[model samples]
Target chain A: MDDLHSPDPTEQSWGSLLRTNREEVLEKWTQTAAANLGGRMTPAEMGRDVDEIYSALVRADTGDQIDIRSAAYADLRSLLTELSRTRARQGFSPTETAVGVYALKDAVLEILEAHGDLPGYRAFARLSRIVDDLGMFMLETYATTREAVIAEQAEALLELSTPVVKLWDGIVALPLVGTLDSARTQVVMEALLQTLVDTGSEHAIIDITGVPAVDTQVAQHLLKTVQAARLLGAECIISGIRPQIAQTVVALGIEFGDIHTKASLADAILLAMRRSGLDVVKSR
Target chain B: MDRIPILRIGDVLLVSIQIDLQDQTALALQDDLSSKIVETGAKGVLIDISALEIVDSFIGRMISTTAAVSRVLDAETVVVGMQPAVAITLVELGLTLDGVRTALDVDRGLALLSSALGKAGSDVEVDDLAHE
Candidate 1:
């Protein structure tokens, strides 16, 4: 423990040591990082990213205590954040992105081995801690960026899933695929209602053929949507309820009330057309 | 209290609510509507609430009561021009307004009212013939 706090005779700091051997450390760091990244980035691009990070790190060293959360390391942390965010968006794994920072430890270790001095070993210990901190920081930023990407994809999927197709002059059909959650139901309701007002359609058909199952909550959402459409003076017909779903609905004792339901989308569309005062006859 | 105007369009009474209705104003409108229906002997009532952005339970109850009062006076009530947001709000608030009929807009409301009254007129005629 006493050896841990032993003062350097020459009073050398990691920052100055890094500066003296900056060219060697940076080249080795970039090379190791490039190899770790599996040639995903060009040599010039990787060199530029590492050069920016190296400059910020050199400036970030205030004293022996390298607290990454300090004001001095703020710039370095921001640079890491930007680098990790881009890597995350580029479909790089968390370990892969973080390994890029950890590569610096190996680069510094090689330099420390060449020096083979007692104070150089102590400085390397502190340097390795800072590298570990930066690696963890990159991991956190990567996680958050991946989370943001996932959230954006979910919103886009919600938009793409609910489409209100115009079946006839005064009829619209909403073909719902996948499971029905409250958030999805709200989107479907708003879109269907807006379309109704836009087209002035008197009849709407909600087809759930792509929907896998129907539970009590799903049934409740359907009822609310139908009631909302009815309040807008548009009749709603629920279609594409499979035989299994029908059994599940009845077994659960969920009352659909007066909302018209059909077995298939075609049947629902036919009902909507007939209600809109149109009849389809086979052409002889 | 501000009174909601009741316009006579042939046999259907059109009440276009263009203001944010307070409780007292809603009550006054209900009173005025009932009196107008009786005076004109209208066969149907169309309430256009498109301009109303905010509708609380008080206004919702007033609309239902107005429909009930119109029904008692031998007139069908068709509420029209309810905005999508307002309709969603009403449903979320559990005010389905089951007994009252609804239409997309004033024109559709008029058509629905006319057709409904036409059916009622023919049924009354059949009853008169039976009585004879």
Candidate 2:
């Protein structure tokens, strides 16, 4: 009959058996600790702790008589929980929180190592569940914060604005200075069109020397706004064609033949004046 | 996204366009631009493209259509802030837009409108001279 209380000589040398068992215990403890501590422990630190626990377990030997099982598992769990709470308050990242949980797993493993033949395996199993729960909680909390940060940034970008100028005779001039997006595009369109009606201007000028580049979508939006303006009996004049923009238009194969274009706002104004039948020399 | 006023420059309204103009936003923007044009009696409309990175076929068509509509209303349409890379990409993609005026910058566009207004005034002067 196999003896349950004593180490088996054929199964493993005493020292080797103790060493292997200690390692398994320490591994479990470190995992548990990592989970309970909100996974904030680093892998290097956890490794050191595992080594220390293994050495301690291997050195303790009571043969077949001593009961090495203790309530150390519960103690380790509480300690890890405190550590996790502290780390959470400090705003640890998800990776760091995961490390804390692993630390607790290591501690639990150490306890198991000391009670290799004990009947308290059931208790250790229960402790495993607690470690898992802590890990999940940390992950959920981290995700929520990350999402909130993204939303805040998007809202901030939407609130930005720029200044513009309008001529008394019904021409509007918008000097674009920075980057543009669909959201900003919509805002610019509404403001300009509304200004057109409010001002009763028949002409509008858009100078883009400050604009860095144009995408296909942006080009299309400009087209849409122009068409929309036509419905209201207004005309759009485009000016300030930097050499780069001209080249880009040519390369893209987008034809602006029918659309009115000028090298500068001065040229656009001349065209608008000619169409309106007003001479700048006489008006001044 | 709801249409919001981004900025005002002279009699030209500069609006930041969100929502795909080819989708629901196009019709909404059309309606809004039409009403604003009537309400403001704006001389011109400048569409800023610094924000849009991609222009699809439907969007291109809508832009052309907007220009036509604006012309019927007696308003001019100008498209501004077209990135060179985007222009190249669109052309390579085989997208073509017609009847839409383009400006490199807002100042030049406004100047064009100003000149148009000046010309209209001259035409009025000519009419007066003819009558006298």
The model with the greatest lDDT is 1
Worst 10 contiguous positions by lDDT, candidate 2 chain A: A61-70
| lDDT, residue A157, candidate 2 | 57
What are the per-residue Cα lDDT tens digits for candidate 2 across B1-132? 556353556677665564434456776677777778877887778776645666676666566676677767877777665544344444444443455556545555566566556565653663453232
TM-score of chain A of 2: 0.53
- Residue pairs of candidate 1 with colliding backbone atoms: none
Where model 1 places Cα greater than 4 Å from the true spot, the runs are A1-11, A20-24, A31-35, A38-48, A69-71, A110-115, A278-284, B121-132
**Residue A145 lDDT in candidate 1:** 96
Model 2 accuracy (lDDT, Cα) = 0.58
The digit string of per-residue lDDT tens for model 2 on A20-89 reads: 4565655665666555544456656666654653454334333331222333333333444454454555
* Chain A superposition TM-score per model: 0.86, 0.53
Best-performing candidate as measured by DockQ = 1
